[model samples]
Target: MAVDMKTIEHLCSLSKLSYDEEGMEKVMGEMGSIIDLMDEIKSFDLAYDDTKDGNEIRFADTREDVPEESFPTEKLLANAENTDGCYVVPKVVE
Candidate 1:
Protein backbone atom coordinates (compact mmCIF):
# COMPACT_ATOMS: atom_id res chain seq x y z
CA MET A 1 0.00 0.00 0.00
CA ALA A 2 1.97 2.95 -1.31
CA VAL A 3 -0.03 5.85 0.18
CA ASP A 4 0.50 9.39 -1.06
CA MET A 5 -0.72 12.86 -0.03
CA LYS A 6 -2.83 13.20 -3.16
CA THR A 7 -4.88 10.07 -2.29
CA ILE A 8 -5.28 11.14 1.33
CA GLU A 9 -6.39 14.64 0.31
CA HIS A 10 -8.97 13.19 -2.07
CA LEU A 11 -10.25 10.84 0.64
CA CYS A 12 -10.47 13.71 3.13
CA SER A 13 -12.53 15.79 0.71
CA LEU A 14 -14.91 12.88 0.12
CA SER A 15 -15.28 12.31 3.90
CA LYS A 16 -15.71 16.09 4.56
CA LEU A 17 -12.70 16.14 6.91
CA SER A 18 -10.01 18.79 7.26
CA TYR A 19 -6.62 18.57 8.97
CA ASP A 20 -3.54 20.74 9.38
CA GLU A 21 -0.21 19.65 7.87
CA GLU A 22 1.04 17.82 10.98
CA GLY A 23 -2.34 16.15 11.54
CA MET A 24 -2.48 15.20 7.88
CA GLU A 25 0.91 13.45 8.17
CA LYS A 26 -0.29 11.45 11.20
CA VAL A 27 -3.57 10.45 9.51
CA MET A 28 -1.74 9.40 6.36
CA GLY A 29 0.57 7.13 8.34
CA GLU A 30 -2.34 5.49 10.21
CA MET A 31 -4.41 4.97 7.05
CA GLY A 32 -1.35 3.51 5.28
CA SER A 33 -0.91 0.93 8.02
CA ILE A 34 -4.61 0.06 7.92
CA ILE A 35 -4.47 -0.45 4.18
CA ASP A 36 -1.38 -2.61 4.56
CA LEU A 37 -3.22 -4.78 7.11
CA MET A 38 -6.16 -5.20 4.73
CA ASP A 39 -3.76 -6.16 1.92
CA GLU A 40 -2.17 -8.77 4.19
CA ILE A 41 -5.61 -10.23 5.03
CA LYS A 42 -6.08 -10.94 1.30
CA SER A 43 -3.48 -13.73 1.64
CA PHE A 44 -5.57 -15.79 4.15
CA ASP A 45 -7.05 -19.10 2.97
CA LEU A 46 -10.57 -20.19 4.03
CA ALA A 47 -12.77 -23.14 3.18
CA TYR A 48 -16.27 -22.83 1.74
CA ASP A 49 -18.99 -25.50 1.70
CA ASP A 50 -21.81 -25.09 -0.80
CA THR A 51 -23.48 -28.47 -0.29
CA LYS A 52 -25.77 -27.30 2.54
CA ASP A 53 -28.77 -24.97 2.37
CA GLY A 54 -27.49 -21.89 4.20
CA ASN A 55 -31.01 -20.59 4.92
CA GLU A 56 -32.10 -23.73 6.83
CA ILE A 57 -28.78 -23.95 8.71
CA ARG A 58 -29.27 -20.37 9.99
CA PHE A 59 -33.08 -20.62 10.57
CA ALA A 60 -32.69 -23.18 13.40
CA ASP A 61 -30.59 -20.71 15.45
CA THR A 62 -33.06 -17.81 15.29
CA ARG A 63 -35.39 -16.99 18.21
CA GLU A 64 -39.16 -16.89 17.66
CA ASP A 65 -40.55 -13.37 17.27
CA VAL A 66 -43.21 -12.61 19.92
CA PRO A 67 -45.37 -9.48 20.35
CA GLU A 68 -44.69 -7.48 23.54
CA GLU A 69 -46.27 -4.62 25.44
CA SER A 70 -45.56 -1.13 24.08
CA PHE A 71 -45.28 2.33 25.69
CA PRO A 72 -48.34 4.57 25.84
CA THR A 73 -48.96 6.48 22.62
CA GLU A 74 -49.22 9.79 24.46
CA LYS A 75 -45.75 9.32 25.98
CA LEU A 76 -44.16 8.67 22.60
CA LEU A 77 -45.93 11.61 20.90
CA ALA A 78 -45.24 14.11 23.71
CA ASN A 79 -42.11 15.70 22.16
CA ALA A 80 -42.83 15.40 18.45
CA GLU A 81 -45.36 16.87 16.06
CA ASN A 82 -47.94 14.19 15.21
CA THR A 83 -51.30 13.68 13.62
CA ASP A 84 -53.52 10.59 13.58
CA GLY A 85 -50.97 8.42 15.48
CA CYS A 86 -48.01 9.27 13.26
CA TYR A 87 -45.24 11.86 13.17
CA VAL A 88 -45.65 14.54 10.47
CA VAL A 89 -42.75 15.34 8.19
CA PRO A 90 -42.54 18.04 5.52
CA LYS A 91 -43.36 16.56 2.17
CA VAL A 92 -40.24 16.12 0.03
CA VAL A 93 -41.73 14.18 -2.87
CA GLU A 94 -44.10 15.62 -5.40
Candidate 2:
Protein backbone atom coordinates (compact mmCIF):
# COMPACT_ATOMS: atom_id res chain seq x y z
CA MET A 1 0.00 0.00 0.00
CA ALA A 2 1.44 3.35 -1.10
CA VAL A 3 0.83 5.99 1.62
CA ASP A 4 0.80 9.63 0.47
CA MET A 5 2.15 12.35 2.77
CA LYS A 6 -0.63 14.76 1.70
CA THR A 7 -3.33 12.20 2.66
CA ILE A 8 -1.58 11.50 5.97
CA GLU A 9 -1.38 15.24 6.72
CA HIS A 10 -5.05 15.66 5.85
CA LEU A 11 -6.02 12.73 8.14
CA CYS A 12 -3.89 14.17 10.97
CA SER A 13 -5.60 17.56 10.59
CA LEU A 14 -9.08 15.92 10.58
CA SER A 15 -8.19 14.01 13.79
CA LYS A 16 -6.70 17.19 15.39
CA LEU A 17 -3.39 15.31 15.85
CA SER A 18 -0.10 17.14 15.42
CA TYR A 19 2.66 15.20 13.64
CA ASP A 20 6.07 16.36 12.46
CA GLU A 21 7.73 15.06 9.30
CA GLU A 22 9.44 12.21 11.22
CA GLY A 23 6.25 11.27 13.09
CA MET A 24 4.24 11.39 9.87
CA GLU A 25 6.77 9.11 8.15
CA LYS A 26 6.61 6.63 11.06
CA VAL A 27 2.80 6.67 11.09
CA MET A 28 2.63 6.22 7.31
CA GLY A 29 5.01 3.24 7.46
CA GLU A 30 2.98 1.56 10.24
CA MET A 31 -0.36 2.18 8.46
CA GLY A 32 1.08 0.82 5.21
CA SER A 33 2.34 -2.32 6.99
CA ILE A 34 -1.10 -2.84 8.58
CA ILE A 35 -2.83 -2.51 5.20
CA ASP A 36 -0.36 -4.97 3.61
CA LEU A 37 -0.99 -7.47 6.44
CA MET A 38 -4.76 -7.13 5.89
CA ASP A 39 -4.20 -7.73 2.18
CA GLU A 40 -2.26 -10.94 3.00
CA ILE A 41 -5.10 -12.09 5.31
CA LYS A 42 -7.62 -11.55 2.48
CA SER A 43 -5.69 -14.11 0.35
CA PHE A 44 -6.55 -16.90 2.85
CA ASP A 45 -9.17 -19.60 2.09
CA LEU A 46 -12.07 -18.96 4.49
CA ALA A 47 -15.18 -21.19 4.25
CA TYR A 48 -18.11 -21.36 6.70
CA ASP A 49 -18.43 -25.16 6.39
CA ASP A 50 -14.72 -25.52 7.33
CA THR A 51 -15.51 -24.08 10.80
CA LYS A 52 -15.02 -26.45 13.75
CA ASP A 53 -16.23 -26.50 17.38
CA GLY A 54 -16.38 -23.10 19.13
CA ASN A 55 -13.63 -22.20 21.60
CA GLU A 56 -14.71 -20.42 24.81
CA ILE A 57 -18.27 -19.76 23.61
CA ARG A 58 -19.41 -18.30 26.90
CA PHE A 59 -22.86 -17.36 28.33
CA ALA A 60 -23.69 -15.04 31.23
CA ASP A 61 -23.92 -16.93 34.55
CA THR A 62 -26.96 -15.57 36.36
CA ARG A 63 -28.96 -16.52 39.48
CA GLU A 64 -32.64 -16.17 40.42
CA ASP A 65 -33.40 -12.83 42.14
CA VAL A 66 -34.37 -13.30 45.80
CA PRO A 67 -35.40 -11.04 48.71
CA GLU A 68 -32.34 -10.04 50.79
CA GLU A 69 -31.96 -8.59 54.30
CA SER A 70 -31.17 -4.86 54.45
CA PHE A 71 -29.67 -2.62 57.17
CA PRO A 72 -32.08 -0.45 59.24
CA THR A 73 -32.41 3.20 57.97
CA GLU A 74 -31.36 4.53 61.38
CA LYS A 75 -28.09 2.51 61.33
CA LEU A 76 -27.25 3.69 57.80
CA LEU A 77 -28.24 7.30 58.57
CA ALA A 78 -26.11 7.25 61.77
CA ASN A 79 -22.92 6.82 59.63
CA ALA A 80 -23.73 9.96 57.55
CA GLU A 81 -22.25 13.36 58.52
CA ASN A 82 -25.71 14.87 57.90
CA THR A 83 -29.02 13.21 56.94
CA ASP A 84 -32.76 14.00 56.78
CA GLY A 85 -34.22 10.46 57.35
CA CYS A 86 -32.26 9.44 54.19
CA TYR A 87 -28.84 9.64 52.51
CA VAL A 88 -27.10 13.04 52.53
CA VAL A 89 -25.09 14.55 49.68
CA PRO A 90 -23.41 17.90 49.07
CA LYS A 91 -25.74 20.63 47.75
CA VAL A 92 -25.31 20.85 43.96
CA VAL A 93 -27.03 24.20 43.23
CA GLU A 94 -27.41 27.51 45.12
- Tens-place lDDT per residue, model 1, 1-94, is 8689999999999999989999999999999999998898778786667766455557767778888889988788888865657777777987
Error of 1 at 30 (Å): 0.9
Residue 92, candidate 1: alpha-carbon lDDT: 91
C-alpha RMSD values across all candidates = 6.1, 9.4
Global CA lDDT of candidate 1, please? 0.85
Clash count per candidate: 0, 0
lDDT, model 2, position 17: 95
TM-score per model over all chains: 0.46, 0.39
Which stretch of 10 consecutive residues in model 2 shows the poorest summed lDDT? 50-59
lDDT of 2 by residue, 1-94 (tens): 8778887888889999978888889999987888778888777787565356565445565555788889888997898998998887998996
lDDT: worst 10-residue window of model 1 = 48-57
Write down the TM-score for model 1. 0.46
